[model samples]
Target: MSGSRKYVRHLSTLVTFSVATLVVAACAPTSAPSGAVAQNNHTDSVLTVGLPGSLSTLDVAHEAGILNYYVAQVSSEGLLGVDTEGKIVPALAEKWKTTDGRTWVFTLREGAKFQDGTQVTTDDVLFSLDIARDPERSPSTAVYWAEGTQVEKTGEREITITLPEPSVNFDWTVTASGGLWITSRAFYEAAQSYGSSSDLIMGTGPYRAVEFQADSHATFERVDTWWGKTNEKAPKKIEFDFFSDESTRLLAQQSGKLDISLQIPASQQPQYEALSNTQVTTVTDRSYVGLTFDTAVAPFDDIHVRRAIAYAVDRNSIVSSVLNGKGEVATSIESPEQLGSHIGVESARSLIAQNLADIQTASFDMEAARAELAQSVVPQGFSAELLYPTSIPELGTAALAIAENLKSLGIELTVTGKPVEQWITTLGTGEYGLSYMSYTPTTGDPAEITGWLLGESNPARYSQSDVRQLITEQAGEVDDAARATKILEATKIALNDVIYSPIWWGKNTTAFASRVLHPEINSYFFMSGWASQIGLTDSQN
Candidate 1:
């Protein structure tokens, strides 16, 4: 490891679904208002974003908090883009390359200035990586970056990172941000006693914090000196109104008090679409509900037991009811949405047509499932425990259906539910037998899944060496088409091993008023947060 990076203690590993939405929104700007509306103390220009959760902090080094996702626009800058269409475009660094198989170099653009008017340099990049790689740092994405990866300030205009391996999908890890984007060293040093309650944030993006009320709400003003310039009608200001209830957010929207609402309750999505002033655009990044078993434990230790559980779940019903038939029932982690370069269908043979053939009409095949369960190593009868996060509605509904379906298979089930935080904590700390989890695609990168699935340090703890090797091979293959093929094959191997029973992915939908334009939407984050290039049109959801 070099100065740019460090080996932190084992990361409580793995990035989850919300981290995806939080990242890009962080890169955009939170501002006061710009243009025509600025003439008024309150302009039509204020883009008031409402989120269901609370913002914990504006600092990226800390929690990749959902609320911070709203204010990230005012906090950070220069990200490697994973655009809305699943394309990896440039956001901060103009161009970058790799060397020595393990070392990667990024060339910073010359004129790019921080929000403070100081030009960006290798030091800023090194410090940012240091934040991510620090054990004391509160990075939500510590797991992926908490390895033998190192970063160095090679030159004024460039930085380099040397990983332990060739890491073919290394760029994808950059996309799997745990909120370690660049921050000013001066501001960071000033905010001492770095605790959960600390009031400290310094980002190099388009906006600066004029007021941070914490939890309840906060406000930001545009930096007139931001380096990147967008043609969009950038807002002069941005405000986030935090509410625990979606009704409060909806009320804000109805009263013409809000310009953008990142989320509209599922039931309200249809109504939002009907409103002439709002527009709804659907974006899908893989968000599948899965049943993961602790293979290190009994029965589930048996492949037969895992397969039986897979057969017991009625995924088709989940697709129709929960997902509104918008997403297909997925059997494998390798989604078709991943760019072919990262996930090739050819290598995923066993996981595809053949493995999925029986699942196309997946149902509660109680009799067959029972027979399979009966063959497990359990002596008399086997009882299965199902754990799920209460915050995720789909998990509860899916768990109930599964409990009922699994009962038909003669396997008694104990469904345990906990709030998202407790449930995730329990997962990493070991408090459940089987759990419901979701994954946010780091990009369209299929190879990205390899790390989560097979990495030795995976919180999921899927310790299959063959699966690990296959994924490792896929990532290191330099040839584009060949890499895709290896990725597909690796996916097939993992699925054949039944790491988890996949359900349905959520269709990402961003609802905004007609006046809110150029959201900078992508699989990762909303680009609208960056005040520089964003333009607001009289647009709707």
Candidate 2:
């Protein structure tokens, strides 16, 4: 592991539902407004966005969802913010440095103030971090900060964090998406319930939340006193309206009621593209969707049984047909974009391809599946249940396909769907034999998702000392190339062990009205004030 200030900075930087019913209205073209009224509407400094899901809470620590993060980012901020290119940049903390990769020091920017007109002090930062790291307060995020880690104010405008061990990618843990959003301690302690509809969270971001209606909509207005550079073309007011139904969202887009719409279903991409005055953009995102097995279970505990199911499922067919050619078949759990963060993308791609070339990947073959099953302890058939969230219908479809394929090998697979909350609880309790896992990477670090899947706390209950050692080494390895190599090695081990079968990597499609200039849509864009990048087109302006 190389030790250098510039190298550390560079390395650190590198780190649904529904449908139907209203289809007829979605297909129908909306009536066009008069030219004069349209021009005025397009030029107005108000941006209305249609989100595919509802926001459950403004306090991401209480209940964190993609939508919740998206909304929280509008007004709140973290110590660091990820740029569109996935590099860690300054936010509340203007500058940061780590000499030994174990202890990090950050210098706060001058004149930073919260939305409530309170000066941001070192006490506020300490208080916020303490709350974020508390297990009871932030159950979903407390894992990022280990028990022995320590944080203290070293100066008036500087804070120091010492991790339990040397971690090259520890900086990512303080990012907005990484779950350490900062808030004023004064406002937080006074509020009866912070981040609620009545007492919305306060922060030092460019926007201030004015209204929040649970599972309905939220509104924000630009703050004139923000310390950071403000975009002249940024919208003065931004609104997020939740549309749980895809068709209804499509209808809203078609009717010109939304300036921007996100998470367009792959099946409805053509429909969204065909809409008038809309520009549809799609990109391969850093999200992993796959099948995980509870290795503690009898049949799944047998490696041969796991390999048999892996060989039987046709991943290519699922990506092409079920995903409508919107995504690619995943050969590994971590996304290529993440692994490529330290090195160039092309180099990382070649490295992964070359390293895993000799490993036996589970391809779709009935004979191979039968042979593997025959070698398992349960040579005969065994019945087990596979569970997925009801919100994601594609997972259910893919589960059915896998169940059908496994039938030929005397395996009786039962596919079941539960509500999102129930599905999460079921997974936490390890109540299912097999399950579907859909994870969105919070940081650019390659270890983010893999650390959870292959780490000691993995839900699969599968353990490999070699893989765990590699993961531990990579976390503290300062050299970019060395860290990437170790990650790939662990990936190979996990893939061969068949603890989790790779499915399809996801693609996100967002539609913007023609009058609105398209914003940079990337994996980390949502972690910052991304909407500020949206502006009126030349013609509209």
- The most accurate candidate by lDDT is 2
- Alpha-carbon TM-score of each model against the true structure: 0.80, 0.87
Per-residue lDDT tens digits for candidate 1, residues 113-159, read: 67667766667667767776775774455555636888877777777
Q: Write the per-residue lDDT of candidate 2 for residues 56-128, one digit (tens) a residue.
A: 5677676544555666667788888766666677888888989887999988878889987888998999999
lDDT of all predictions: 0.55, 0.70
Clashes of 1: 46
lDDT of 1 at 383: 84
lDDT of 2 at 182: 94
